[model samples]
Target: MFAVTFFDGEGWREGVVEADDDGQMLLREVALPADLPRLDGVIVGGFTDHHVHLELVDVDLLADSVLGRVVDLGGNVTVLGDLSARFVSLRSLNDRSLSEERSDETKRPRVARTSTVIEFAGAFLTPPGGYPSDRDWAPSGSFREIASTDDAAAAVAEMADAGATRIKVASNSDAGPVFDDDLLRTIIELAAARDLPVVVHAQGPGEAQRAARLGAAALAHAPFSERLSDEEIAVQAASVRWISTLAIHDDPERATAIDNVRRFHAAGGTVLYGTDMGNGPTPVDLHPGEVAALREAGIDGLALVRALAPADPRDPASVLLFLRGDADPLRARRLTPADLKV
Candidate 1:
């Protein structure tokens, strides 16, 4: 049996779980059995890192981590697609093995493991001669440059066909030319037609506000280039969900980014935990630095957990996170890959 703590979308609750008939684990709203030894940790819902570049990391290492799901914000479509298929195959094999083990009257669930789910955004959709196009880190086929408004529909269609659940638009005016208002709107409109949310890498002055004003579902990062006015912050808080990649910048900019996120979060803006992992020497699992940065932004306790967890913690299909050391909900931090059980 395992002792656990979970946020039920409203408040944190304590629970106990044990392997049931057929070798599946079940959560119970009761005390731990006195005779049974408890696992040394508290269980929460599986985590999802909303922004990652899988092509730049050793994705296979994620199999043992608590990140049950990862959203590939930008990557080579073909490579990401192949990687996604590989995880699916592994999941099937694991499930079949578990079923076979149950038939043999196994007493314990095998090692408590699950494959990391991949939700890729295919590639970065940018304008002709745009950011990342000239960068060596972005491999071939990782970015599709839309030269005109006529190209928006086709570009979005191509990504949708490649199993993209979302579209990533690159509006990094700091590097080079970015998508103008009309072209960006066209892409957003086309993406909407396919029921895909447009998440933009909004950089440079006023870029974040532009993405928000034009109905972007999310910002790939909190606006870090410049300090947003109070009106801009309110607008973003109301409509845009900011993925907290707060630990990826250097000081002055990093401090500015934190302030932006702090105000945005204070105004009731939704913040999702994300580490632009491939961009730097970031860890593959739960990042302690990112967690601490979020704390500095005033998102602590249950609010912090909500940002780190999946949208629905109650989903039985979602992976359970066994946090090892500090189990106190209010003081949860220092989460590393070793802390995770599944």
Candidate 2:
């Protein structure tokens, strides 16, 4: 058994773990034996950056970074589909290594790292001439415009067909036209039918509240344009998850975004770590700036670690362990991709 320290959603605990043949840990609640060989570091499951754009970043770099998985909130379906396929193929190829390749029995296997898992929301489902449609940064086939109820249904259907793990909708009123209440409702319902959660990029006044009222599963960015009322924040905290893209904004908006996330988290809301990478200039790997912003927003230590864990973090054994030698595991900034094995 190897000595380890892991985050159990609420806090970190010292424990002993056993690694399977594939170098994955079998975490359990057991007493640590002093005589057993112990590794000199903390161990954490795989980390995921909840929001990203594959089109803008060199995705290959993420495989070696601290992030084991990334979710592309909006991108060209065809491009993202092909990219996801490529990662799957890489994992398949890597899994075929000979068992005898491990020359040392005492030391744990140093398994070859596989490509980062890419979970994408096929395209930005938006109204005609919506936010990203007018942005030059958005690639072709990245945003699908929905003009009617029929359009919303078809757009959701197309995304589902493309193997989108989630449906991304945009309501950037500052950029251009946004979906009306009826149309937005239609899209949410359609996504629910396909068992896909809907994440919204809600910009402009009241857009964030509208998304929560209409049952969006998450907000791509913390509400930056407006300050939500206590009542509004409370209601949203009960049902919606907010992705922290706080560091991406400039002053004033940056302060407002951090305040919103602070309150939301205080109200028992689920917060996911996301940088909105590729929106402008951001790191392709684990972002220290984003981590700083989250720390300022009252999410730090084990709470911050929980945000970076896999989306479905129920099974601890399924994720990779991050080993940080002689560093404060609570300080996420000190942890990097080099600390991860396999």
Return the top candidate by lDDT: 1
Which portions of model 1 show Cα errors greater than 4 Å? Answer: 1-4, 13-16, 21-23, 28-41, 102-109, 311-316, 324-342
Displacement of the residue 13 alpha carbon in candidate 2, Å: 5.3
Query: Which tens-of-lDDT digit does each residue in 1-342 have in candidate 1?
Result: 556665555566777666543454556667656665455666665678999998888888897677878999988888888899999888777767765664443353343355788998988999889988999999789999998877888889988998999999999999999988998998999999999999999999899999998989999998889999888899999999999999998898888889999999989999999999898898888788888889998988778877876433344444665555665332332222233244
Worst 10 residues of 2 by lDDT: 329-338
For model 2, residues 1-342, the per-residue Cα lDDT tens digits are 666666665666777666456553356657888776655576665678899999998888776676668999999998999999998887766655523346566754455455578899988998778888988898889999888988888888888998899999999998898989988988999999999999999999999999999999999999999989889899999999999999899989999999999999999999999999998889887788898899899998668878886322225323454545543333332222223333
lDDT of each: 0.80, 0.79
Provide TM-scores for the models. 0.88, 0.87
Count of clashes in candidate 1: 0
lDDT for 16 in candidate 2 is: 65
C-alpha lDDT of candidate 2 relative to the true structure: 0.79
